[model samples]
Target: MSITVSLLLWVICLSCHAWLQPGRYGLPPPRPGYRPALWGTRLLAPVLALLVTTRHDAIAGILVWCMTASLAGLVVACGLCFGPRIIGTDGRRVARERRP
Candidate 1:
């Protein structure tokens, strides 16, 4: 259960981290108000995950947190790389849109 929670939190954290920098991903810029929410989630989720895990077990919690963070990072990276293709989006189209 703790592992699940940690994984979810890490995924959310990484996703928000990615969203906070659209140019890096070749995505459209976010709205001004949306940035605050992304920043909050990106900053808060990892700490919450850490607290939840450590509350369960100190030594083991840290280990599990590290494992979950690594797996979650891979998950987010795959999602960013392949998600658009899965949804029929073209890389070139996104690149075109990114230009002024």
Candidate 2:
């Protein structure tokens, strides 16, 4: 079960990372720093999920929890970094169409 959950989490994280790659949504190319943070998030997600599921050792479990929290934080950061542009553009289109 732990393995399956870890695999699922890894797949989701990888998909999200791939979707954020250059030209995925026709967005401008990402800055170099962006790649490392995004890749690190993708790499850590599976390890965290595994730790959460296989919490046999106390110290290991705590470390996994910390990693999971970091993963969540990175996800939030990614959203903040990219979400506004998508939302802002969509909102502008809707407003323009509604105008007289």
Candidate 3:
């Protein structure tokens, strides 16, 4: 059971980390400083998983950690993908959108 849980966490962490990369497998010069953030996700997932699972007996603690990880992953992905949309999106459509 612990093995399964650990593998699941690794998969989830890497997958979430992938989302943070801009290009294919983070190739072709990813956005500056993105790699460090990705590494953090990679390291954090398993540590957090272990921390939660070992602190309590049986599968309940693992389940709690799973829930927490899922929620956190959702937040990170959403924030990265839709961050620009949040700027002044008061149901208003502008004639000219700002460009970087």
Candidate topping TM-score: 1
lDDT of 3 by residue, 1-100 (tens): 6545655675668565755543433323346677677778788877967775767565676676666566656655555455543222243432345789
In angstroms, how far off is 57's CA in candidate 2?
Answer: 11
The best-first sequence of candidates by TM-score reads: 1, 3, 2
lDDT, candidates in the order shown: 0.83, 0.55, 0.58
True-vs-predicted CA distance for residue 75, candidate 2, Å: 13
Ranking by lDDT: 1, 3, 2
Between prediction 2 and prediction 3, the one with superior TM-score is: 3
Error of 1 at 99 (Å): 24
Off by over 4 Å in 1: 85-100
* Residues 11-51, model 2: lDDT tens digits: 56654565465344323445777777777778887667766
Residue pairs with colliding backbones in model 2 are none
lDDT of 1 by residue, 8-60 (tens): 99999999988777767656667999999999999899999999899967999
Candidate 3 has which clashing residue pairs, if any? none
